[model samples]
Target: MAPTTDPATTDLDRVIGFTIPGRHARGRVARLGPVLHAILSAHAYPPVIERLLAESLTLTALLGTTLKNAEGQMTLQAQTEKGIVSLMVCDYKDGELRGYVKFDAERLARLGKNPSLHALFNKGYLAITFDQVTTKERYQGIVPLDGETIAQAAESYFLQSEQIPSVVRLGVRRDAQGMLIAGGIFLQHLPEGEVGRERLHVRLDHPEWQHVEAMGATMGADELADPALPLETLVWRLFNEEPEVRLLGGTSLARGCRCDATYIQQVLTKFPETERAEMADENGVISVDCAFCSTKFPIALADFVPDAL
Candidate 1:
């Protein structure tokens, strides 16, 4: 089917944060347009991989926006024993994100179209890492890839590790012209006593939480992927019955990369002289490609020489 071209979604690339103040529920809605296309178009990825990458990017955006104290970067990574798709990583810091997939193209091709998540990444484990730039401290969680989708894996992460009741849904589809569009929404029930301030815990027995989960499940692909459906409209449609729900606000997102000549040079300097020499081409220039943005940078060997050396 041709993708819907709702004017509301057109050119929209932002994450909207919302809250059910009375019910102690908070969530985020993210819709990506040009930003998503630009990232996927950089490489000739298969339709399956395209969809998977879109889901990862959307999930990263959702997680990044909801974080309160994160200063550096958060990464979601998965590796499988099947070798069809060995690794997938999505990195989010601030409001910017970049991700890439490492897969066995030949093996993936043989699996046929629309393979199951397990078929793509059999016996895999999913890991989430938080790198705090200011404190130079790292925290991470690893979970077995038990669900049918990445969203399910993420939901499990919150429930099993963080003890937070969370729900996440991600959608990615191609329009008639083959341009990709994606959207994601996340809902988590706040802890008791205080909404956002209480200790992390799960209370699935809460009546309101059940109602919210049911409403969120009704979200259709068109509703999420359609550019014409404004973020407010989506929230309203999902929880109109709950008048206390509040639309907090939103923030913009874009395709961004931190890789540059300076950063690349610093990395190469750590390599021994023999390794650096081996990396250079005939012109004595080292070439490195940023897998996230697919940007290529070339640096002269002299640039890596330390002044004190």
Candidate 2:
């Protein structure tokens, strides 16, 4: 029988990253594990598309963790000719994260399995938004689509927006039984000054940079998505060469959508009174489906009118 849960074993459901010794570089590996299993279980997606979304989720989580600035969420979105594309930004603050995506199924279908990010989103621009709940101001960075894959696009975003040089590798795959698995690794250039520059320069000057210094075995898809693999072991296996490597505690990741009745009611109120009445059902209830989570909510007609209005 396939194992259910084993805390001692390393599995495909964890995210791990590492900092290279003597180099101002860091790498990360993340596996969606059971959380992704739960999220996609109820939904039917083609293996290609499923993998795409899964990788996006994992990448989002990794980026969210790396980019620490405020206590609110970071949002990544794209408007494509194929359809509306989106990624939720969740942070460590209060464990709050949410996101959704809308794609043209027909268009995506024509593209076939394993569609390129550029092919799926031709002529689209990426927008990264940072929302601070406590403050009234929301900051946004917009950039043109440059990369061919999600990883490339994201790396471009970081370079252009934050001026941080990073290398990101993303993968999405499914098993023989149709189980979805998404995983990725990110190598980033840590901020450095004169001392740091000198260190990297000396290392590069050495012939060892060209030699294959096998520290550990190459990581495979099975290892990345396996829930049985302990995160620490995985990190050690991939990056034990780094003497100064530090293990930041792993954070739990999930598929969460920030859609509900209250927000829907506020949006409906903005429509004309006639349009609002037309949308009402026979029982005088207005039903709306959240674009993110597909949660349906019914609002009473009386709730539409504000007490002050």
- Which candidate achieves the best lDDT against the true structure? 1
TM-score of every model?
0.89, 0.77
Worst 10 residues of 1 by lDDT: 1-10
In each prediction, how many residue pairs overlap at the backbone (N, C-alpha, C within less than 3 A)? 5, 12
Q: Which digits, one per residue and each the tens of the lDDT, describe model 2 over residues 46-134? A: 56556666777777667665544446676677666544243322222333344445666666677755567777777777777766667
**Tens digit of lDDT per residue, candidate 1, span 155-191?**
9988877778788988887666666888989999876
Clashes of 1: 5
Q: Which pairs clash in the backbone of model 1?
A: 6-228, 8-227, 8-228, 9-227, 9-228
Q: Give candidate 1 misplaced runs (Cα > 4 Å).
A: 1-11, 135-137, 194-204, 306-309
lDDT of 1: 0.82
The per-model lDDT (C-alpha) reads: 0.82, 0.62
* TM-score of candidate 1 on Cα atoms, chains taken together: 0.89
For model 2, the superposed segments whose C-alpha errors exceed 4 Å read 1-13, 16-21, 67-70, 82-98, 132-139, 175-177, 193-222, 266-275, 305-309
Q: Looking at model 2, which ten-residue stretch has the lowest summed lDDT?
A: 208-217
